[model samples]
Target: MHRSVTAGAAAAALLALSACSSSGSSGSSGSSSPAASASASSAVTGTVTVFAAASLKNTFTQIGKMFEDAHPGTKVVFNFGGSDTLAASIVNGAPADVFASASLATMRTVTDKGDAAGTPTVFVGNGLEIAVQPGNPLHITELQGLANPSVKVVLCAKTVPCGAAAQTALAAGNVTVTPVSYEQDVTATLTEVGLGEADAGLVYQTDVKGAAGKVDGVNFPEAACAINKYPIVTLAHPSR
Candidate 1:
């Protein structure tokens, strides 16, 4: 959700699926928006199970509902989790119709396994930020501030894209941070800051935005080096 688009048009374009012919191999990999638009116009019926990154929970949920509203009989179910975990599940034979990852590294796991019908597409981009308690508590203004021993910071595990981005940003600033906890996903990292259990957490900008009054976000220049590109792909074998 880095670059917002009209919900209807964006949803259609993002989930644009090539029409599946009698031969299962006939479906296009959806390499471009025009192709997706063309396929979206066709009446698509049946349920689609989407495995997506944890960061896309709110946006994708809205898109799923809109897609269902537009296509009455087409159901959109979702499995939201850390991108790496979701990718591993798909590569391990989990039945999912779509795979949307927060980073290209995770998407490669699926494409490299030949689980995707075609190449994955970059739909959106996001950047990392520091999530702190409201009222500017601890007054964290930059990446190096989190390195303070008293900051009580939290971060996503290295296995996740957010964690990877955090590391890159920290490296860019030449800062070393030791978090109080390592979360499995972005939401969990945000939760620590929201509940005041931790003074700050490294999460995506969208996550901080969603937190509203529960937390405040601090933007640092180092985050520019850690911007993440989201990728989505249609799975080769879907279980309906």
Candidate 2:
């Protein structure tokens, strides 16, 4: 799914201010305090739209609420989905102010298109883990356990960050496990395990954390090799 920022007018205002500031005298007080205050107040009364990877849904939503509270009348809206899909949308002219991708590859899509405001920053790191129903019902232990034909496994599609990490981990362990489904995102893969639709699934540690009591997480040594870094960027022409 793709979500676009709806603050088109707000963004235009901000951009106008930025352009004016760049051309006006740096020592001018008119462009200093007023512009800064306007920029700050923009967040206080309007909306800021963010597009993030599915794995960041819980954490980012919590942070967004805190941000809104700090700014009183401001609202923070988010669109969460696969990093690849989100990048594609942004490059295609989606109105997004901020973007947080699960992997650098996806973030590059926006940067490559000259759509980013500034250099992207690494905000977080996550490692792969096996998610299963509570109580270890399947007796799944290591990555190799996924190969058990009796165990129904689900994994993210190769184009998604989590799926690529899972593939690397599997390669490190030299095990090829067949999955019943290829999810579009890590959260979807974890959801399948939580729902008991699959015996197990490979997902990010952060995803399992968000699932809370819905699933159990098992750590494997190979996951260290599959650690993923999340990157965030502010678009060059934000729609506020």
Candidate 3:
């Protein structure tokens, strides 16, 4: 998925102030001191809508909660999906303040359209892994193991970042796989294996870690060749 601050720092500050002013909340009661009231009146409050990659769901949820707590009345709403899909939505005029994509390529879609508030930045990196049923039932091992005819694999569609990374890793290992299905996103591909619908799937290492008991992660040396850099940018949209 992509990584960007919801808005530029100044814009975010302005948005927070706007939310505080609209709520018309006086932080202290009538008995409070004037200085205390002034302090309370300056509290930040507003809703920031963010478009993020599916893989960031868990981590970003935590971050959002912390931000809301720190800002008191501020709200952070997230729309998590494939970076490519989210970029398309933003370029097509979808309302989003921040975008965090899984790859620089997806981020470029928004940047190319002049939809970004500033230069995109790389915030995180992830590598691919093999997700399988909770045990070594298939005895699958590496990128080579996925090439087995009976593996019943699911891979992300080539257009998606994770799928593209998987392809790079496969090429590095000189292995081939004919997936039974091609999912539009890494989460969906992981879902197939988590639900026992497929024997194995190619997904991000973080995804396998997030799935916990639903799937087991198998790391291969070839994953080094396909590490994905996550990029984030603020969209050039009015603050909510």
* Per-candidate total of colliding backbone pairs: 0, 0, 11
lDDT of 3: 0.76
Q: TM-scores of the models, in the given order?
A: 0.87, 0.82, 0.83
Q: 1 or 2, which is superior by TM-score?
A: 1
Model 3, position 8, has a per-residue lDDT of 39
Tens-place lDDT digits, model 1, residues 56-155: 7877777777777877666778899999999999889998778889899999999998998767777677888899999876888888899899889999
Error of 3 at 70 (Å): 1.0
State each model's C-alpha RMSD to the native: 8.2, 9.3, 10.2
Q: Rank the candidates by lDDT, best first.
A: 1, 2, 3
Task: Write down the RMSD of candidate 3 (Cα, Å).
Answer: 10.2
Q: Candidate 2, residue 128: CA error in Å? A: 1.0
Candidate 1 overall Cα lDDT vs. reference?
Answer: 0.77
Q: What tens digits encode model 3's per-residue C-alpha lDDT throughout 156-228?
A: 9999899899899999999989999999898899999998899999998878878878999898999989988
lDDT of each: 0.77, 0.76, 0.76
Candidate 1 runs further than 4 Å off: 1-32
